[model samples]
Target chain A: MLKRTPLHDWHVAHGARMVEFAGWEMPVQYTSVVEEHNAVRTAVGLFDVSHMGEIRVRGRGALPLLQHLVTNDVSRLSPARALYTPMCREDGGTLDDLLIYHLGEDDYLAVVNAANTERDLAWFRAHAEGAGDVDVLDETDRWALFAVQGPRAEEVLQPLVEADLKRLRYYHCIPGTSLAGVSGAIVARTGYTGEDGFECYLPAGAVHEAWEAVWGRVQALNGRLCGLGARDTLRLEAALPLYGHELTETINPLEARLGAFVKLEKGPFIGREALAAAKAEGPRRRLCGLRLLERGIPRAGYAVHRASAGGPDGSWEAEPCGYVTSGTFAPYLHQPIALALVGGGAAPGERMAVDIRGRLVPAEVVPLPFYKRGAAAPGS
Target chain B: MEFPQDLKYTEEHEWVRASRDLAVVGITDYAQSELGDVVYVELPAVGARVKKGASFGVVESVKSVSDLFAPVSGEVVRVNGALADHPEKVNEDPYGEGWMIEIRMDDPSELEDLLSAAEYAARVE
Candidate 1:
């Protein structure tokens, strides 16, 4: 049986198409993918990201335990600040990417991908066995996460949140605040949509009431009730890496272009030696963006080949240089775009061909993100 | 989903409208709703030969790609050129402007193999 979130019934009532994702029955789209995608890009959108897992680490040994577990410097996180980092195995491959929030001294919350919750929790517990005063607790069922994103996100959330939304900076959080009538909610100024937004972490039982309070304001702004489909596309346009697609067990942070988040200078961590060696050796394959020059929708697992020539009539090289990690018809760009991990000196401005099914669709290797809001979109 | 009474349907979720030996084809409303927002549609070129129960084109949505199976063997007389630029027509008007191709049938009696509107609706339900 698939696990259901607190808002599962609400999603069904709102005409959302439900799909089983990562062992949870979640809404893939509330209306249509394009409409929801456009809503987040143009205005504001709300998402029930309750499927995301949360783990709480508390006690005197919390900081030391976290420092050893993740690649980023946990000590750099001040009070009410969130740090994005990738947790890796001893082999330097990504275990899961996490967002650790320092609620207070010795109190932290690490948000992980839904599918990796149990594994991450087990890993944390195993590491904390010898570490003193560290309490690793699985809080996945204790919280319900709601993400309100886009340019008008503040306008919709400001009136409901007691904390000053304007005062919250990026990658910061306000803990123990009343949000949408739910007291003690965590309002974090962080999101996956690459927009100015807040992630409201409410008590699991209070989510229904909180959702009702926020939805009214959301509707006033013509905001949409987005789902996982829109969430995936929004993150893709932002060039954010998804756990399974971009950062797998075999794919390290360096190859995934998330080297900035991995702090090797912070001293010894789980994958420090391997990661440092991998860095010195350089990346085996680098993640890059691809935009189709022809009319074709590139899908995941599609073969990416070097183009012999530049036009639609050009032929593809026999050997595939890479494979698409995530690809879709990017709604905001109104074009088919993809993120691929390629080797053999592929860079921006080089021509490539994506074997979409059997057809060699002409494409070009572009910059990372396919769309950016205020700035000019690359490869447009 | 609207299943036009005048059209015959296939289990693959395609609809065919027969006019003498020429047949107009497109995906049904049910198919469009199931696929979500249509982004691209690849149709066979004009004068292309298609076989019954074989894939004749491709329809891509934001999250998935589906094959448009031929309901009857025929020679394609015309193809929808507008879909190259405006694929949303498949979701907006699956039975009307979204018509994919006009096929000159090799055997008009093949329409007997398709389900009626009521049968199609029952099958989908």
Candidate 2:
């Protein structure tokens, strides 16, 4: 049976096309993805991200337990600050990528992917066995998340919430009473779209009211209700890695070019030993951005190839180098772009070919983030 | 919403407009709206023989890919190659400019089994 969020009726009422995503019935789009994507890029957009898992870890050992499970050093996070980190297995493969919010001295919340909730909680429980007073609770069903993202996101959200959103820096969050009447929603001044935005975590029952309030405010500012399709495109434009596509069980954090999150010097995490070794000896395959040289858009699972040596039969026949992990027609860049996992030789400016529908489309290895809007950067 | 009573439809959301032994095949307006923006369309080659209820081609949007099923067993007389360059026409006008293929119907009587516009709309709901 498919689960439904509190705003499922709201989505249906708003003409949202609903689909089963991660066991929950969610809206894939309200309008066109291109229009919604452009809305978030240029104006403002809201997303129903209630499907994402919110796991709370609290007690005296919550800090140490989180530090041990994730690649990032959680010790550095001051109260109400958040850190984007990758949770790895004992073999250094990524279990999932999550955002760790240090809510208080003994409280921390890990927002993980919906599909990986059970696996992540299992990992935490197993690893955090000996840790002091640690409690890992899956609070996914208890809350509803809404993301207001874009340049004018703050302007739309500020009127409804009492929190001083301007004072809340990027990656910082605060607990506040909802103006929509949900008392204890956590408003985080962080977003995946690489735009100025806020992610609100409110009580599940009160989500409809909160959504109505936010939507009204957004409509007043000419904001849009975006869907998962636009959410994926916007994040891809920002070069933010999707958990399953960019960072998977088969992919290491270092190879995904997220080494900044991996603190090898930090003591005794689940994948600490293997990660340390990977850091010492560089990764075999590295993820890089690709800009298509031809008309075709490069898509995920398309083989990356280089021209083979020798005669026309071999020379003209491209040799498979790697594969594209994610690709999209970047609305912001107005060009086809992709994230490819290629060999070490595939450096920036290097030429390659992406196999699209049995044809090799020429592409160039480009720098990460095919489009960057304003001053937003990774970890900013 | 704008179901032309003259047209016949399949459970798979394909619309068929028959003219003697020649039939025009396209997706319904409901299918187009559900699929969102159609980015690329793969059509069966001209002269290719297709079977009723078989996969004939694919229609890809920005979000998902859907198979185009043949409503009647026939030989492909012509394909709308214009869709290769401009697939969004399907979303704009699925029954008109978005007609996927023209088929030389193998059995014109098969159209009798298909649902009329009202029946198809009822089935979808």
- Evaluated on chain B only, candidate 2 has a TM-score of 0.97
lDDT of 2: 0.87
Worst 10 residues of 2 chain A by lDDT: A371-380
> Model 2, which residues run further than 4 Å from truth?
A177-181, A293-299, A308-315, A331-335, A374-380, B20-22, B44-56, B70-81, B104-115
Residue range B10-59, candidate 2, lDDT tens digits: 99999998999998999999999888877778888999999999999888
Q: Candidates' TM-scores?
A: 0.97, 0.89
DockQ metric for all predictions: 0.95, 0.40
Query: Best-fitting candidate, measured by DockQ?
Result: 1
Candidate 1 B-chain TM-score: 0.99
Q: Is the docking of candidate 1 incorrect, acceptable, medium or high quality?
A: high
Q: How well does model 1 score by local distance difference test?
A: 0.92
